[model samples]
Target: MAKPIVSMINVEKWYGANHVIKNCNLNIMEGEFLTLLGPSGCGKTTTLRMISGFELPTSGVIRVEGESVEKKEPYERDVNTVFQNYALFPNMNVFDNVAYGLKVKKVPKDEIAERVNKMLKLVQLDGFGKRRINQMSGGQKQRVAIARALINRPKVLLLDEPLGALDLKLRKQMQIELKRLQRKLGITFVYVTHDQEEALTMSDRIAVINEGVIDQIDVPQKIYNHPATRFVAGFIGESNILDAVVVGRNDTGIQVGTEVGNALGVSDDETIETGDAVSIAVRPEDTLFSQERQPGFSIRGVVKDHVFVGNLVKMMVTLNDGTEFKINRFSEDEMIEPGQVIYLYWEKEKGKVLKTRNLVNTDSHRDIKGGDEDEEEGYAAEA
Candidate 1:
């Protein structure tokens, strides 16, 4: 098994009276691409800064290679950072910028030239050594920043949304390039980004943070399919969440009485028992719609709207109780119009039953399911 290259145990950070990172625990494996993903002000950038030595935690320990790095300066740590703003020397050419680290160390002039040339080639900027920083495009400048950060031969590379400034097409292209580079170099990468698709495309593992809380950390497929919490389910992808109560256990899994209707869900939480309230998260892609009722699915809804996007279609489904559910299907499938009644169903395994931490109560007859609905503090409810 690969050992963890970086570890954060019970890490917490604060700014004056504001508590930012709260009781965070993470393990970044060696030579793996791990992403810190969240929305704005969710502490993803702050977490990256702490790892890079720009910020210090108020409590807990951060270790690199089994050694404490709390007191180490950014330059002293075995990591290099690439910022979103491409912090290259505007006064110097590409070769000079890439060779800055080697020059600062007073390395032999001959060795510096060789290393700079090789680094530029590794970033696919081989012949642009003599070009000025202002002469490069956004993508080219980002490549230069990466080349500079890597030229130092650091054990780990930290990138804080390095592709954020580029256009959509360029960002997608850079995602593939960055992943390929990380795999080739075999260096641990601690990347920070709020973009879900980017994290899904580039990371070996993704840590989803919300309001300083590390909610879920897992592989892309698992994170998308088997979200451990309600926040993770709605954050990583489009999901149809329904309030449910555990009715009973069966051979396939547990049975749940949801707001829409009775449904079967994969029972992942052993602590949950009959009568306990839970949330059922089913992805839009997993949901199936038909004009007739289907087996194993008892939910009924009316098609409220349909949106066509290139090869896929997004549907807005309103249940009998007036809750809206979203569904995604291929554009090639049979189309259904507004106000048409449709039966919703999915495989038992497709539904993820998550244990909610906090429940909100109201005067309505419907029993509130367990979930944190503190949207004012960075948590949002998904329909």
Candidate 2:
């Protein structure tokens, strides 16, 4: 196995009385894009700061290439950071800003120009060398900042919400550009972001940080489709948490029951036991609505509201237990009116039972053997 490029072993950080990070252990592989993802004040940025050498851990060790870097200065380590605010030197033009690092390192003038031009070209800023920092747009300035950071050829790049300042459109564009740059350069990237969509779109693996601990770490698809915790399921995307009791567990799957109904649940955990309290998650988009009965786990609900949202429709359904859930459907699907009793169903494979610290109460009658054939066919294309 290839050794990890960076490792955090039992890492802890404290700000006087407040514990900012708690017993963190992470391994960043070479050339991988790993994101420390969470909401605001979740310790993600503090973790990033620790790795960049700006803030030392109150306890624990951080290693770079199999050696401890706790006592090293930020510049002494082979890493660079790009912040939300482009942090460019306003006094210098693009060329001078990007070349500042090399000049400080005392690289010869001829070599500095060659390296600077190459970096500019790599960031798609080929001929903007003489442009003033103030004259460039937000995206242009961000590109210049990226070029400046990459000019030094750091083995790792740490970004803390680097796209937060840009408009939505520009941020999306930069996300793709940054992903391409990481792949082409093959440098490990440790990204920090509160945006779930950005993490899902660009990360090779996502380490979801909650409070001061890592909730889960996995590839984007696995993280989205098979969340390991209740927090992971709720944070990565929208989920309808169903509270239930375990009826039985087998090699195939487990059976769970709510106050009003019961359904089959599949768990990644093989240790699920009978009579255990658990919560199952069903994505709103994974739900299908119909007047005719369908097969698989299901529930009967009265449609409370239908909200038109561009190409998507948001539905509010209330079960007999008053457990309300939000379901999403394509706008083209004929709308079901409020006060209408309808069936909501999903396949056995689409539902997940979780054993996190907290369990939710949810109820829906399931008809596992009856479904609309046409609706089943459309599920793949729409979902």
Candidate 3:
């Protein structure tokens, strides 16, 4: 097996009494694109700073290229960082900006010119070398920042929301360009961003962080399809979280009862048992709607509102008990009108039962056989 380019072992960071990063352990393989994804103030940027030697950890060790770098300064480490604000020299042109690193190292003038030219061309800024930084656009300046970092040929590159300053269209274009450059150069990239779509587009694996803790680490598809925690399910994407109770279990599936008087047979979670309170999560796109009842568990609801959002229609359906559920239908047909009664159903395998109580209130959960009394009382209590 190939060795990892960067590794963090039980790393922790604190700003005085407030803990910023808690026990972060991760291994980034060589030549892989890894993204640290989370909301603002979730320690993603702090973790990146620690790895780049800008902020030393209060405890634990960080290794780059198989060597511990706890005592090294930012410039002494075998890594380079690209910040969100492009720190280019306004007075210097693109060539001089990219060549500044080599000049600081006191490299020969001839070698500096050749390497700088190659780096500029590698980032597709071949003819823009003489253009002043102040005259260039936002996207052009970002490319100059990347080229400056790459000229060092470091073992690992750290990016702290480098694309955050660009507009949406330019950001999308840079995402593709960055991925291509990483592949061609075969460099290890440690990226930090709060945008889920950007992380999904560029990362080989993502570490989802929440409240100074690592929630789960996996590929984009696996993280979306099989979230280990309820927080992860709700954070990564939109999910319909329902409070339910486990009534029975077997090898095939487990029976669950929700506050809407729907007894659902969902995949069994090994940690749950009979009489255990649980929360069930289902994506809005996984449900099927009809005018009449279908086989298995079904809920009768009236379409309270329908919103047309370009490619998809978002419908808000309210049950008789006043419980509202949001469903997204991807169709170009005429929108479903409000006040229309509809039946909503989904396949048993499409929903996941979660044992983590942090997702929903346990006291409001209802039993399957409790009928109308359970629905009315539980719904009222939640309200």
In order, the Cα lDDT scores of the candidates are 0.85, 0.83, 0.81
Task: Put down candidate 3 lDDT per residue, 149-168, tens digits, no spaces.
Answer: 99999989999999999999
**Which candidate number has the best TM-score?**
1
What TM-score should be assigned to candidate 1?
A: 0.91
lDDT of 1 by residue, 1-383 (tens): 78888888778999999999977778789999999998999999998999999999999899989999977999999999999999889999999999999999999999999999998899999899999999999999999999999989998999999999999999999999999999999999999999999999999988888788877777899789878777788889889888787888766787888767888789556777887667888888888889988876789999898888887988988999999988887873555788999998888899888765532211111222234446422322332
lDDT ranking from best candidate downward = 1, 2, 3
Higher-scoring candidate on lDDT, 1 or 3: 1
Q: What is the lDDT of residue 1 in candidate 3?
A: 61
State every prediction's TM-score relative to the real structure.
0.91, 0.89, 0.88
lDDT measured at residue 30 in model 1 versus the true structure, 0 to 100: 92
Residue-by-residue lDDT tens digits, candidate 2, 71-174: 78998898999999989999999999999999999999999999999999999999999999999999999999999999999989999999999999999999
Residue pairs clashing, model 3: none
Displacement of residue 105 (Cα, Å) in model 1 is 0.9
Worst 10 residues of 2 by lDDT: 360-369
Error of 3 at 373 (Å): 32
